[model samples]
Target: MKTPAIAGLILASFALFSPACSQAGINLENTRVVLAAPSKEASLVIKNSATEDLMFQAWIESADKSEDVPFAITPVLKRLAGEQQQVLRILYSGKGLPTDKESLYWLNVREVPQKSREENTLQIAVQQRLKLFYRPAGLPGKVTEAPQQLKWRLLAKDGKPYLEVTNPSAFHLSFAAITLRMGSKGFTAPIDMVAPAATTQVEMAELPNGVQANSLKVELEVIGDFGGILKYDGAISG
Candidate 1:
């Protein structure tokens, strides 16, 4: 069975192969969007980096697959000239969304390129998706501290080793990499995001014949603001 994150990624990959007029060139100013409380709106800057003009569409959807959304994006359709930029305004209606914890959403930007006059030429459109984080005011703790506060444990079930991670805080943690170190040997798990107040178990590779789980040290690199990675270290539970 595939995990939720893995399934979403598969679907996104399938979307890239759909029919399109041509390839588009664009640049997003940020990899993620953060909307804090008390602010009714947020801005995302998108630039058409190619020499030719391009048409684009932008929208927001719940990352959890919910139908009802609490936010709206302005100028859903736009035509930008080469080297031109547009500011996408995201406004929160201040309803139907949680005010106690951070909520996760996805912002999708699709580029529609112009068709070529030459026949037998294929065109491919590009779609970009970024994480959208809605942070409510007065959260118990800071987001920067949430990664280190995660509860970690190593366990064996059905003769297989697994690493369990639990996020107790009300902030979402997006990890870029997770490494498990035991003595001089180390194992790395694929990157994944742990939602606030949720738990995820990552299956580990076969351990050395005599190695034990309890002696391993866990290290994770989380995606931070401005596309940086923040490192955290922890030890497995007894």
Candidate 2:
């Protein structure tokens, strides 16, 4: 992945991470920072899901898009918690990007310390999901058509059977019901939507009973708001 000169500059100023929970309560929910932008730089808005006072640390981590890449975590944000919503921002510097008029980056957020049992579960689940927001670090005023599909293939450590999928649209796709089917077995996509113009390869090793195969048939069926459906299918050999 050779990053363009612009990407080089974008990578330098970029700081990507997930959001923190804002309130302090038994069901303290996470405060999320959503991404949006016109330039190569990306920004997120962190919102609290709880109704009470709260505080916690925050930080970022690189998602395991592939088994070949080692896990990398960003620096931690200390004493960052509140009841109201907050904003966390990141800028991208020069970085390698695909020359095919496409670019990608990983964005994640880890909780400082879940305040309660419920909060702990939320944080843990988010961590396990390995949430990453993909971005298209294109140059200014460049327009590209959104992809009609998103695809992925997963391989087990034993190299027996794995999973593969192709999403039919570039719009935000829900991962809640997205599952990996192997004969009678099934596993869900760890997180939600694969950012537009990006291909997300979710690591299945961390999923329940997910690492015991070499190769297998994989498919993804996603539901849309208009009662429409998106599906992807393919075979992967471990």
Candidate 3:
């Protein structure tokens, strides 16, 4: 019989030759829209599957009815690991809304790779419809009174994402143009606003990587402010 040291070496060699194990993966869960008690900012949840650990990143893009739209990342590129999940949030403000109300959007989630290569990278993309409308809240010349609440909704239109804004104030809050700013990428869209109670939507642009999808970051800009200070929603990429 072989000595203990020789036997140990043989066992170690055999273990090294063992095949890699393929574990099951997790699915996205609990994706729903949430609105604050008296605010326009909304929060959405992204749950992961219960199988293997995962890494992911988030991004937003513009969608057009008959053309390829543009999109950008909020934080450039990011990485996520398995068994762990992250929450991607976006703030909705009415800006350059299309009068057509037929625009769409695609929210993308991509998986990061343990090793970097063309074949090993995987991506998952979710397409949503966008509907955003806004109107002023509070009466004009009422300085002492609280501003009326601006009603906003990130709607799930036929299993898609959309937004609408409602203004309730006497004064007109101009929401003329919308600019989608992601990382160093920018896209401008022209639109008109209604006084006191206008409803409209802006279509989303296509992602950078076409159908395959990748990790990315995103931010939304309406007229002047950056969606009332809520910025950036993202995920991991390979």
Candidate 2 lDDT over 216-236, as tens digits, reads 455655544333455656455
TM-score of 2: 0.38
Task: State the local distance difference test value for candidate 2.
Answer: 0.40
lDDT per residue for candidate 3 within 101-161, as digits (tens), equals: 2223444444432332233232332222222222223324431111233444333444443
- Best candidate (score: TM-score): 1
Taking all chains together, each candidate's TM-score versus the true structure is 0.87, 0.38, 0.30
Candidate 1, residue 85: lDDT: 96
Model 3 CA RMSD to the hidden true structure, in angstroms: 21.2
How much is 218 displaced in model 2, in angstroms?
11
Which pairs clash in the backbone of model 1?
Answer: none
The TM-score that candidate 3 achieves is 0.30
- Judged by lDDT, which candidate is best? 1
lDDT comparing candidate 1 with the true structure: 0.79
Q: For each predicted model, how many residue pairs clash, with residues at least 3 apart or on different chains?
A: 0, 43, 45
Cα error, candidate 1, residue 46 (Å): 0.4
Error of 1 at 57 (Å): 0.6
Q: What order do you get sorting by lDDT, best first?
A: 1, 2, 3
Model 1 superposed RMSD (Cα): 5.7
Per-residue lDDT, model 3, residue 48, is 49
